[model samples]
Target: MSKQFAFTAEQLKSFRENGYAGPFDAYDQNEMKETYKKLRAEIFDRSHAIYDLEHSSLLAGYDRHLDIDFFSRHIMRRQILDKVEGILGPNLLCWRSEMFPKYPGDEGTDWHQADTFGHASGAPQVVWPMNTDFGGAITVWTAVTDADKENGCLRFIPGTHEEMHYDETKEMKYSPEQVNKLEKNGMKSGFFGYDYRNLQKDPSWVPDDANAVSMEMKAGQFVIFWSTLMHASWPNTSSNRTRLGFTARYVPTSVRIYPDTDVINEYGSKLSLDKYGVVLVSGQDEYKHNRRLLKNARGLEFATALDELETA
Candidate 1:
C-alpha cells in the first residue's frame, strides 16, 4: 500500500514537468496563528540558538531547529517528509532551515537559482557524487503568515530547474544599502543584500516573467520546489502586512553537507559550524558524511523517520 501523504502518480508527473509541487496543508489557520505567536517569542530568545550571534544579526534566522522545540518538530513533520520522500526516495537529511521575512514596503527576493549555493560564500555548501550532472536541494518553504503578491509571495518559472541560468561559483558583492534601491525591469526586488543578477551566466539575460507563476499561500501551508528552479518574489506593496516564510532544505544522505567546511561566510557574515549538525528526518544514513543530531538543545528528541518508526 502507498504511504500516507505520498504524492499520486499524476502529481509526481506534474512535479517532474513543472519542476515544483503543491501548497499542501501542514497546519490549520487557527493553529498557525497561535503557534506563530509562540514562535515569535522563542525566535527572539536565542540564548541556546546554535549560532553565537545576536538576535538582531542578519543570519540569526539561519537554523533554529537545533535549539527551538517547535522548529525541531516542524522540520520532521510526517506531512512534509511523506511528500519529500516521494521525490528524494526514503533516505534524506535536512541540512538547513532559514527564515525569510518581508515587512511592508520591503523589496522582493530577486530571481535566483541555487544549485551548489556557493554564489556568495565561494564554497559549495552541498556536494553530490561525481558524474552526476545536476545537484540541488529540495526546499520546502512554509508560509508562517498569509502570503500574497501584495505582501511579497513567491514567484516561480515552471520547467526551469533542469537548466543552469546562473553560475553559483561566481561571486556577488554584498551591499546592504542596495536592498530596496534596485529595480529589475520596473519590479522591486533584491537578493537579501546582494544583487543576484551578478551571478547570472549571461549578463544580458533576464528571466521571462511572462511564463512565471505567483505562489500565494495561506499561513500554515507549504510549497515544495527545487532550489535550482528559476524563482523569485514580488515586492510587498501592502500597508502593514508582513509575509514570513520558513524554508527547510533537504537532500539525499549520499550528498555531502558543507564539504570539509567548519565555517560559512555569506550574506556579509561569517558563521561557525561548531554547533551545526544535520537532522535525519527520514530513512537511514549510510554515508554518514555529516554530523547528525538526534535532539534539540532543549533535550527534545527529534521524531524518528516515518519508515524507521513504523518498523520499530
Candidate 2:
C-alpha cells in the first residue's frame, strides 16, 4: 500500500508506527480560532437545534459540522486535497466529515472501525472483492479549544491500520441501541456484547506500550489520518471548559460509493452517497461534474496564517 503513495520512507514508517500523522496547522491560526468560535455559537444554539442530539442531556451529534460555512470549503483546499491526489491519485470524494467534539465531562467512547460505521455497505474488502479506497480517506480535525487528556484527547494504536480485520459476524458487533446507551451513560454502561477481534488493552483503542499516544494539539492545530486508523477518545474532565472541533473527510477517486437509502434529515429525502461527491468521484467522467467543488473553491490555500497562532 505504501508503494501506491508518494510519501517518503519516514512518513510511511511513522504511519506504520502511529497509524496516522499531522494535525496539520496549515492555515492562519487566528482565523481558524475565530472561525471556530463563530461556528460553535451556531452549533450549540438552542433554537436552530438542528445539531442538538442530546435529547435529554446526552448524545449530541446534532448541529453537525457539515452544515458549517468555513470548514466545508476549507477542508477541500487544493494544498490539502492535492496531497490525496499525490498519494492516491486524481478523482476524489468528500465522503463525510464529523464534529467529534469532546466537551468537559461529556464522556463517550467511539468504537473503532475501518470505514464509516463498518463500511456504508454491509460487506468487508477481504470477504468480497470490494476494494474500499475510502478506508484510506482522509479526515482532518482541528481542535477549537486545547485538547488533552483532561479534556478527552484522541488515542491511536500504532501499525493497526495495516492489519487485516477479523471475519465479520453477529458475535462481534454492537447494536445501534447499545452504542446509544454507551454514549448516553458512558463506557461504564458496559462493553459491547459482541466479541471484537484483534482486541488490545487500551480502553481508548491505542496500544498499551509505546504504540499509543494522545492527540494534545492546541486550539488551532489539527490532525489528518486514514479512516481505518485505530482511534478513540476519553471522558472530558475539565472544570468549565468545552473542547470543540471541526473535522472533514476526503477520499481519492477510486473508491466506490456505499449508497444509503435512509432518510435522516427533516427534508425526508433519501441520504444517498450521491449527495456527496462519491457518486461523482467514482465515475469514469467524474470531473465532468467536478465544477461544483471547483466553483465554490475560490481563494482557499495553505498559508502563513497558522504561524500567527499562539502555540501554547
Candidate 3:
C-alpha cells in the first residue's frame, strides 16, 4: 500500500543516498509574503513566548512554534509530516524549532553535523535507544525568503549523514568576536558564535567541497534533511537581501529530547526549559519519555491528527 504525500520510492532512495531532499512547496508565494510580514512583527513580541527571555535574546529563536499560531500550525502541517512520516514512521514528535537569519554581511553557517547535540551545551539534547546506531532529528527547514547562493542558501555534502565527522562530546568556546573574523578554506562561515571545526574528530580532515551542493530555494519552499548530515550555508553577499530559515526538527517518539535537563546552555546564553514540551505531530506517543503539550504558551491549541493516521 502507498501513502499520500509520502515520498515516492525513488525520492526515498535519493534521500537515503544524498542525505537530503526537496525544495517542496508548502505555501503560496503571496500567502507566504503576507505571513512573513506578520511573522516579522509577531517575532518581536515575545510576551507570551515559552522562554522567559527578552525578544532580542540569542536563544529567542529556540521554540517560537510553541507560542506563535502560524509556527504552531506549520509544524503540524500534513505537507511536511507526510514526507517525514515516510522515514520516521507514524509516531512523530516535533522536539525543537529554531530560526536561522542571515543578514547582509553575515557569515555563513560552518559545516557541521549533530547527533546527540552536545557539542555546545556539554549535555545531550536528544538521545536514542542504546541499540540504535543512528540518532538525530529530521530537520525541515522552510525558507521565509528567497535563499540563493548570494543570499546564504544552505549547502550539503552528499552521503555524509551515515558517518559523523565531528565528535559531539567535544567542547566549543563561544566567541562572539570571532563571528565574521574566521574563515574556513577562505569561505566566510562560522557556527553561530563558535567554530564548528573545533568539534571535528579529525582536525585535519576537510569537507569535500567538490561534492557539496547548493540548495537555493524560493520563498515558501522547504527542504528535508537529516540533522546528522554535513550541512552549511554560504555567506549573504547580497547588499540588501536577508536569508531567513525556519527549521522544525522532528524525531520518532522513541527518541528522548533533553533527556534529563531542565536548563539549556548554548549560543552564549542559557534558558530554562520550564515550559518546554514536545508537540506530537502524528500518531500516539506510546513511550511517553518526553513531556507533551496540547497548547502553546499563548493558549493556542497545537492541533494533532494522530487518531487519523497509522501508529508506528
Candidate 4:
C-alpha cells in the first residue's frame, strides 16, 4: 500500500472521535462522469448478476461488484484499500456492495443504523466473533455523481457508532407500495420499502438532527464510516439532477458473513446464495469463515491489495 493514500494520525484520531472520515478524492470529475455512463448501461444488464431480480426492485442494486468489471476494480482500488486498512487492519473482506440512486422528487433515506444488517430479513447477515467489541462493517461510500443537499447527500450524527439505536432482530414490515410516500419530521423519508423507525429500540424516540452533518461531495469523492453510525440523507428536491452513490462494505477476515444462510430474503425479493462469495481485498484470510471468490462472475481475477503492492 502506498503511504500517500494512507490516513494520517490526525485523520485517524478524527475518525475514531467522529465515527466517520473523509471526502477524499478517488477519480477526476471527467473520469467519474465517463465511468458513470458505462456503469448505467452495465447495471441494467443483469444476465450475469448473482441475484435474479428486475431493475425496478431495490434489491437489484445489491452485490454488482461480483459481476461488473468496473465495480470489481472499484472495490479493490489501492486508494480505497489503503484507507480501509488504516481502520480495519491488514486483512479485509468486501462482503457487500450496493448502488444507491436518488432521482428527482425521491424520498430521503430514513435515519437508521445497521449492526447485524437484518432489520428487514429477520436474520443476521454478518456476525462478528463473540470476543470482538464491534459488530458492524466499515462502509466506504463513493459518490458516482455530485451529491449535495438538493440531490440527497448523506447525513451523519457523529460519535453514535458505539451504541445500538435500532435492533436488527426486530422485524420491520416491508411494503413496496409505501415507498416515496412516507414523511418524517416534515422531510420525505423512508427505508427503501420499510419504515426503519419500526426497529427503533424506543418507539417514541426520534432522531435529533440538530447535530447532524451533511456529507456533500463532488463526483468521485468517498467517505468511510462505521455501518452502526446514525445516518440518513436529504431528499432529492431537484427537477433534473440525480444523486448516485456506490457503497462497498468491508470487515476484518475474522467476521462471518451470512452465517447459516443459503438464500437472502429482503425487499420483496429472494436471492440464492449458491453463487455468492466475498472478495479478499487485502492480506490473507486466516479464518476462512465465509466463502471466498478468487475472481468475478465474468472470470476476471480480482486484484488484491497484496497483488498491487507486490507489482508496485
- Candidate lDDT (C-alpha), each: 0.89, 0.49, 0.89, 0.92
Rank order by lDDT, top first?
4, 1, 3, 2
Q: Assess candidate 3 and give its TM-score to the true structure.
A: 0.95
Better lDDT candidate (3, 4)? 4
lDDT of 3 by residue, 1-312 (tens): 456678999999999999899989999878988899999999989888888763253477889999889999999888899999998899999999999999999999989999988888999999998899778999999999989999999999989999999998888998877888888777788887888898989999988879899999999999999999999999999999999999999999999999878988887777889899999988789999999988888787766733433332
lDDT of 2 at 219: 74
- TM-score rank order: 4, 1, 3, 2
Q: Please provide TM-scores, in order, for all candidate models, with all chains considered together.
A: 0.96, 0.64, 0.95, 0.96
Which residue runs of candidate 1 sit more than 4 Å off their true CA positions? 54-57, 305-312
What TM-score would you give candidate 1 relative to the actual structure? 0.96
Measured by C-alpha RMSD in angstroms, how accurate is candidate 3? Answer: 2.4
Q: Which pairs clash (backbone N, Cα, C closer than 3 Å) in model 1? A: none
Clash number for every model?
0, 10, 0, 0
Which structure is stronger by TM-score: 1 or 2?
1
Report the C-alpha displacement of residue 161, candidate 4, in angstroms.
Answer: 0.6
| Candidate 3 lDDT trough over 10 residues, lowest sum | 303-312
| lDDT of candidate 4 over 1-312, digit per residue (tens) | 365699999999999999999899999988999999999999999889988774467788899999999999999887898999999999999999999999999999999999999888899999999988998999999999999999999999999999998988988888989989999878899999899999999999888888999999999999999999999999999999999999999999999999999999899877899999999998889998999998899987888744755787
Q: Which candidate would rank higher by lDDT, 2 or 4? A: 4
Cα lDDT of model 2 by residue, 118-208, tens digit: 3322333211115543344566676767778787777776566665342222233434344324532234221232224323333344333
Screening candidate 3 with a backbone cut-off below 3 angstroms (N, C-alpha, C), the clashing residue pairs are none
Q: What lDDT score goes with residue 62 in model 4? A: 93
